[model samples]
Target chain A: QKEVEQDPGPLSVPEGAIVSLNCTYSNSAFQYFMWYRQYSRKGPELLMYTYSSGNKEDGRFTAQVDKSSKYISLFIRDSQPSDSATYLCAMRDAQGGSEKLVFGKGTKLTVNP
Target chain B: GAGVSQSPRYKVAKRGQDVALRCDPISGHVSLFWYQQALGQGPEFLTYFQNEAQLDKSGLPSDRFFAERPEGSVSTLKIQRTQQEDSAVYLCASSPDGNTEAFFGQGTRLTVV
Candidate 1:
């Protein structure tokens, strides 16, 4: 199985809708979870980051991690057209020596007016 | 520089040609990483450097790919005899330290014909 798995969603939603993007990992050693947003022709931009389990909130975005289930999620509340982009989930273990991030296939999202 | 910068924002090369991509990371950052992102996929880790020392390169796809950070500030990724499969957007990211949040560059998109 791949280390990280995310649905390649071409999800379409109306403005102001709540959007949830999720990813699951098979590697139990992963300790840091991150969410990135990428627009076409640009690189991925860091959105939210969390260590271990639990949840973190920043403005209209929230990130959640469940280490017990090896799953992670990003929720966008009252989404806007500016939120239309590809969301990527990334994780890395606390190996101390190496911090290479493992990423899943991103989910493409489009928020229409 | 305020952010990570990559050169040759777009590159097109014939198959079997050798190509060199450059990355200028944020000043004083201790960690530098290179990732490859294919069309519609999230970025995949390729290699990492801690200052001028390369600590991990386990994700390099093959012997044809090589990366170096001679002065610890500017890094370069060189692909020898590139193939069509080598076509992808090469991204560079850097962080203040090993375990901190990383900032990415506007990647260099490479297309091999």
Candidate 2:
């Protein structure tokens, strides 16, 4: 199986809605999980990063990881039009493995005003 | 530079023509990486570099693809006899350390026709 798998979603949500993006990985060695936002013509920008299992919150965004299930998720509360973009889930192995990140096919989000 | 920078934001080359893409990472960053992003897909790891030493290149598709960071700052990815399949957005990212969050460049969009 591909290392990381994410649904390619062109999900449309109204303003002030709650949005959730998720990814699954088959590699149990992956220890670093990250979420990135990418606009139409720009590169991916790091958003949330977490290590191991548990939850991390930053402003209106929250990241959760479940090592046992090998699943990771990003939740956006009160998502706005500005949040309309592609969301990419990326992970890396423990330090000293491979520094290069493994990414999932991004989910395109369109938060309409 | 303030962030990772990449040259030739957009490039169009005829099939079989070689192409060279450049990346200027953030100063003092120890880890550098190259990734390929195709339409509707997330970026895929291509290679990784530590200073002037190329640590991992197993992600490269084939021998026709090569990358180098001769000076430990400026790097180049060269695709020899580029094919249509080689057309994709090439991205460069860097982190202060090998195990931290990374910053990405605007990316070099290569279109091989």
Candidate 3:
């Protein structure tokens, strides 16, 4: 099994709808969780970052991590058409001075007008 | 530009031909990373460098895949004899340090035919 697993959903929703994206990791040593958004022909852009387990909010995005369950989530409120992109979840262990990140397959989201 | 930059934007190579992709990281960044993103998948770590020193290359898939940050700035990923499976987007990212978030380049899309 892959270290990190995510449902590759081509989820389509209307504007203003709430979107929830999730990923589950099997590694227990992951301490840093991150969400990245990638558009066509572009690199992944960091959207939200969280340390260990807990919740973090930024603008219309909220990220949650549950170390106990090995799960992480990204919630988008008031989603817009501009939000259409691939959402990727990535994690890294706290192996001092190491910055390697393990990533999920990514879920494609499209918010319609 | 303030962001990381990758060259050739797109490359098409014949099977068994060698190819090299270049990345120019953000100025003054200390940590550089190389990743491979296959179609419909998330980016996977390939190698990492701390300045001119490659500290981790455990993610490289084969001996044909080689990366080097010769001057601790601009780095290159070279494939000795490319195969169809080598077709993917090569992403380069840089951070101020190991403890900070990374900034990524648009990436170079390589197609081996």
lDDT digits (tens) for residues A14-100 of candidate 2: 999999999999999898899999999999999999989999999999999999999999999999999999999999888565788
* Model 1 misplacement above 4 A: none
What tens digits encode model 1's per-residue C-alpha lDDT throughout A1-113? 88999999899999999999999999998999999999989888999999999999999999999999999999999999999999999999997689999999999999999
Is 2 or 3 the stronger prediction by DockQ? 2
TM-score of each: 0.98, 0.98, 0.98
Q: 1 or 2, which is superior by DockQ?
A: 1
DockQ of 1: 0.87
Query: For candidate 3, lDDT tens digit of each residue in B4-105?
Result: 999989999999999999999999999999999999999999999999999999999999999999899999999988999999999999989866788889
The lDDT, on a scale of 0 to 1, for candidate 2 is 0.94
> Which residue pairs collide, candidate 1?
none
Find the candidate with the highest DockQ and give its number: 1
> What does candidate 1's lDDT look like per residue over B16-94, in tens digits?
9999999999999999999999998889999999999999999899999999999999999999999999999999999
* Cα lDDT computed for each candidate against the true fold: 0.95, 0.94, 0.95
Docking class of 1: high
